[model samples]
Target: MASTTTVPALKADRPLLGIAFMLAAGLLFTLLDTAVKWLTQSYSPVQVVWARYAGHMLVLGGYLLILGWPRCREIMASVESLPGQFVRGLLLLAASTFAFLAFRELPLLQVYVINFSSPLLVTLLAIPLLSERVTAARGIAVAVGFVGVVIAVGPVDWRAQPAALLPFGMALCFALYQLATRRFGRNDHPLASLFYAGLAGALVSSLVVPFFWSPVALGDTPLFLLVGTLGAISQLGLIMAMRCAPASLVSPFLYLQIVWATVSGYLVFGDVPLLETYLGAVLIIGAGIFLATRKR
Candidate 1:
């Protein structure tokens, strides 16, 4: 009885740990967004992404250094789903590419608001991918959240800003990335998962970045480094987050990034989100809060 009770108690803490990981990921995500937005302004999105993955590789190197190559190789060999990790890494790379492209044209707050739709998209993808049950409340909340997205884009004249639609694509990629992470990340070593997250991306970018590369100004070199470090650490945090908690429970915590995005947008870019964005964000946030606070 004691062992059974202890085991269940320990198991219950995983979701909380996942939420904590999401919270940290959310903050780092905001910083990443700000950094990427800045870098993409001066560099090709592809080149900026190359710097990001380059940094990710450096950070991943440090992680492997701590573990030693033998253990790292062993973890790689022992992975139950190396292909899954590879797929997820590609998905994340695609998501980052979409985000960088969108951010070059959109404000941090607006881009993030559109990006917030990933939670809803995750909720939907969870059904088909993870086979999680969605209650009516969740379904309705998802619908309303999307309504907010439409509202945020402006009920009319949305076509005037075609760039606004880019984040919708970004959101879809990110949602799929999140779902893949949750689906396959659990039994793999965090290091292995982290390594593959940037492995394919770095390789692809290394080959292609030269065609699009521009010289980084001396003062702006740090931003290149920042995106890579933030990318690696945040990717690790997200891997741990999904491993710790269900996609449904943790995905909503991502909305917290909106607050950080808003602040960072104003502070870094002196940009304010349009009124429609606030209205749309409220609805999206409300739906998320409902899902997050509901009974288990």
Candidate 2:
């Protein structure tokens, strides 16, 4: 009886660990974005993105090596799902590239606010792409979430600044990337997707990075490397988090990233979002949370 009781307690602990991982991942991702923004000031966003992917690959490769040759071979031998993995990687690359380009022009807080809409997009896309059934409440939640996005965009005419739409585009790409992940999850180990995500971006970027690469200042090389290292760590954190807890329970924790982004943007970039952005964020976040918790 005591052992059974202890088992339930141990099972309950998993979600807590998952939430902790999600929080850590959020902060790490925010730091990666901060570094990317800093890098973009001196290098092209393309070059910065390449560094992000290359660095991710380097770190992931080191881990696979440490896991021993058999583990490495197992990861490499998984070929049936490569196409899906490759596409997911491409979508993430596109998403990150779009956001980075917008980062060069927009405030970090605004970029985050727009990007966080991915949860809503995911909720909506699941209905059509995955054939998941969505009840009326989720439909309303989705609509309200977009209204939040509009508010986050502020009162200015959106057409006046085409660049403002970039983060939304990023959100769309990311949502699709996630959908692909869900599709691939049925047949592949999560590690396989991670390997392919890093591999896809690293290989494709290698071709173009040369054309865009500028010599880094000697002092900044560490920071450049740091960007990729943090990205890899954050991605690992996300995987661990999912393994630790239910996806529905842990996912809502991701919105915590906007809090980090807002604080970091203010301190690092001196960005102060207008009231509209804040209100929109609240709505989007509220709707997202509701969707995350509502019966799936």
Best by TM-score: 1
Evaluated against the true structure, the overall lDDT of model 1 is: 0.83
The top-ranked prediction according to lDDT is 1
Q: Write the per-residue lDDT of candidate 2 for residues 73-176, one digit (tens) a residue.
A: 88667645677678878988999899889888888888888887777776666666656567898789778978888887776567887788899899889777
User: Model 1, residue 82: what's the lDDT?
Assistant: 77
Tell me the TM-score of model 1.
0.92
Model 1 residue runs over 4 Å out of place are: 1-13, 155-160
TM-score of each: 0.92, 0.87
* Alpha carbon lDDT of each predicted model: 0.83, 0.76
